[model samples]
Target: MQKNPGAKTIEGDLEEALFHAGAVPEQDRGCPKRFDWARSARTDKGVSAVGQVVSGRFYVDPPGLVQRLNSILPPQIRIFGYKRVTASFNAKKFCDRRRYVYLIPVFALDPSCHRDRESVLASLGSENELVKCLECSERGRKVEGIMGKRNFDSKIGLDVGKLESGISSNNQDAGTTEEKIKDFSLGANNGGFDIEKTEEDEVLVQDVNQEEVKAIKKSDFRYGEEERERFNRVLQYYQGTHNFHNFTTRTKAEDPAARRYIISFDAKTTVNVEGIEFVKCEVIGQSFMLHQIRKMIGLAVAIMRNIAPESLIETAFRQDVDINVPMAPEVGLYLDECFFSSYNQKWKDSHEELSMQTYAEEAEDFKMQYIYSHIASTEHKEGVVALWLHSLNYRNYPDLRFINNNVNNDVESLGIEAKDGEK
Candidate 1:
């Protein structure tokens, strides 16, 4: 239901599709159509959900209703289970906490720093190198726009320079090859395009270029022990109450609503998918600000890669810093689970008990067929993350204020809260 578009042309997400499928004809259906349809979490576009809950009222609640709903809806959108809740239930407010898992390819963290790894690891955030990486990328993009993209190699104070000269030269950046074609993509390689001429390419990601392309492969993108330890420590900082005003846009730093409670955040090197390994990050919290999770991961990756200092994360939490945080690719993020502790406790005590549990086996099957398959294919073939990295440089990493690349902007004319509510 999360990644798949609904059947109706009006609204295309799971929630919208469910409402349509559950909806009965106005005249024949009881009650006032679908009343109080609420979702536990509003997953962003392209995000998959294993445990998502929704509650609403229909005129009739007959036996096999769940089956009927699935029969009517798309197979990609399945109802794992359903529960009856009290009249006081408010899916948005009453819920206690939400948990999410973001699975990024381990290669994204591949130190891009070759032999100088020792020095880079020693001083992860020594001199704000990440700013250099971002700013340099910004300069390249601006040059590409103003000047011909042919001369897009804008490399001043690029963090990749920190690498050993030998390793730096041998490791050509894949992005440079993308510049040749009008539509740039990492997956666009091996498509009968002659990249042999693009070999002398400079300005790899963060101004890194590998002379020996075969020396590094997608499998080569990985995190070392030192990078893993430091990333985990940085993740710990995400917990507890903090002002994430900079993580999102439009909200003022002084606004009390900007303060959010994070219970825990952790990450580890995992090779869950075939031929690819990535840091699997999970964060649990009462709620998150818009684009909060993506930005958090982006900053962490920058620090881990030794492109930026660890202090950037701290400054982001502070109200005084006017930092427009950069976001990692949204393709890697997923809404893993949502918890309703208080609601479940109350229901247990009362005469009625709500079945808020999920069917894990079935849920896993659905995700593999519909969700993970798309992510893997897109990552391997289409180069979603690569395109997103390029996008970070778009508009010079402008403020992440309500940009919905997933839903067609054309739908905005229809007006159904396009990309509204939840990060």
Candidate 2:
């Protein structure tokens, strides 16, 4: 029952609608005076929730209440139906498990979809050459922005002589792509949109270009069984409980909270949305931290693309190593369901079971109309996955490089120095 924070939120909208609907007393609206409002789960900005539940004391009339509230709320926010719970019921504490679904573009998992094969070859060539490629790629991005997008081939106009001379002169002082990624702040908030209403009408989100949009739609954008199997193998790494301190921010490896239990995580199937194909990944876990789900998806993509080795997943779970795991865009993530099995088992005789089954049809319709539609439209227009994959190549992970070297025998040909034991 607090003052609206200007930007629209589900809870904020609910509170306002309840007050206007006479479901809650106007006086009991904020701070100590407000009714206790608890949500089953909280999602970050731009993340949608389909089966989110809330509980609190309200002056509900029980008849026409859902319709009355729907009239006041926005099109995206809806009140399906309400249930009377026990006086001591708390939505947050009583919730046992949460399920989240991530819709990732097939191109993000299919290495063959990447347009910059030449850049990938150059990135693995030598340390200095990697730096040059990153710099040239940055410059090309700026130019692409100014002139709009023409063609991917036209953008790979690198001056070999000038780049070679520059690399020779600055080899000792050249910075890696890792430094550029930090400076550009690509990993912050895992690239989620921050919606703060300003004096001007604007929505802050990741920058997009027509070329990237065209790039995503240009190819068949389909993956074969081999690619699907690889993506699933990468996801399998996150199935068990692990120390995921590196997956999110601020939490240290020593902190007990850093460890999260993932009951299961898998790529369920490929979904065709409009013309683009998406890999539907479903994860069931006790809980997830900020940007945790997105980072999981990001790291999986990194492994699938060969930018990072599969073993890096195991290494990241260890306390000694702190990896800067990239975050996927927030558009595709949504809260699928919340479980209250314990409470239902205990209180079933007296009160109704706290389940979303009654509203399953409504939830699916809502997701199709609002959540899925938004994700598909955003991907088609913004090309969030393609752009994110491009930035990932700039990363120079030590373990990844080591694994690449071990697998490829042409280290000398690529200008990388052989180890003491190697020929």
Candidate 3:
């Protein structure tokens, strides 16, 4: 249901099919409820969402549901949005996290059209060259600014020492209240004015004191240099909750700017099998501006690639940099997760359920594709092997099938029985 150019046509077809099947009630036959669905920014003609959420009541027979829907739905689209929700539950507000994955194959080619091997090699080299150039251009820039609990500009009015002092005072007040309650309870148990401490009570008191000491000791927290900087920047902006109207994009023409509090920001890196690496930048706030995540990612990518210096992030915050740098593509961005103080457990459970559902759906798709590939290979055995081997060595090595087959008997070594099941 998430936006497709052909959605209106599909909806009409579905309505007609349901009418023919007598699925709708007599009263509702003349008026089917319309639905409003959201589409991704990059959705295109042939592309489709694998896991889109939609909510609506439909009257249909269980036995004929698949048939009726399939008859109306296009081959590229399917009904993957059939979730039930509570009346009070809002999908956007209740969602704690939305994770998206962008997949980029190290090697790819058009399968339908055949090209000369020499041209294919030349194209691959050109792509590599372009990627290298981009990487080099990105690496030369620097970004500057303090992160957590640090002073950005003196004018911003940050007082870290005072904040820490307040936290310490609060801790002392809590401790004093706890001690007074314990003393009061002890006094009540004692007769009139006399106070007596049993050996068991003394031991219990000692254990409790030790535990409190351990807890206090464990509470001593510190941040790494980079982490401290990132945290300070977020806290500086997020501490006093405000409308981030200017920070984010508006969905509706009249919708108010989003109210947000910076929760946290963490940056890390990942290394792939081929020694290629990527920096993973994660920022969490109460709410985000439209495309904010992607923008942040773009900044980070710019910094890591050296296209912008570390100072550039702070400059952007100060509105000093050119705003023309469009946000990074959504494919490489993810909604990592969201945070909620109220109904945290429910939100967590829902996220887990959604994640598991996505995984299962993806697994099923993979399974079907695997089956299809095996079937196709069975019908074209020699061609499949040749294609597979060509893919394996296409990037870095030469095609040495003749050498391998003659010298090491790789065909037999691979457990492929020669014709008549003999090696």
CA-lDDT, candidates in order:
0.51, 0.61, 0.31
Which tens-of-lDDT digit does each residue in 256-339 have in candidate 3? 454445555554333232221223344555555666555554444333322334543333332111222324433323322222
Ten-residue region with minimum lDDT total, candidate 3? 163-172
For candidate 3, the lDDT comes to 0.31
Q: List, residue by residue over 346-395, the lDDT tens digit for candidate 1.
A: 77865233332335566556555555555555465334454344444314
Model 3 misplacement above 4 A: 1-50, 64-76, 80-83, 87-90, 102-289, 318-322, 330-423
TM-score each candidate: 0.64, 0.72, 0.38
Predicted structure 1, TM vs. truth = 0.64
Per-residue lDDT tens digits for candidate 2, residues 222-261, read: 6678777778888999988999998999898889999999
**Model 3 CA lDDT for position 265:** 55
Lowest summed lDDT across 10 adjacent residues in model 1 is found at 183-192
lDDT measured at residue 68 in model 3 versus the true structure, 0 to 100: 49
lDDT of 3 at 98: 35
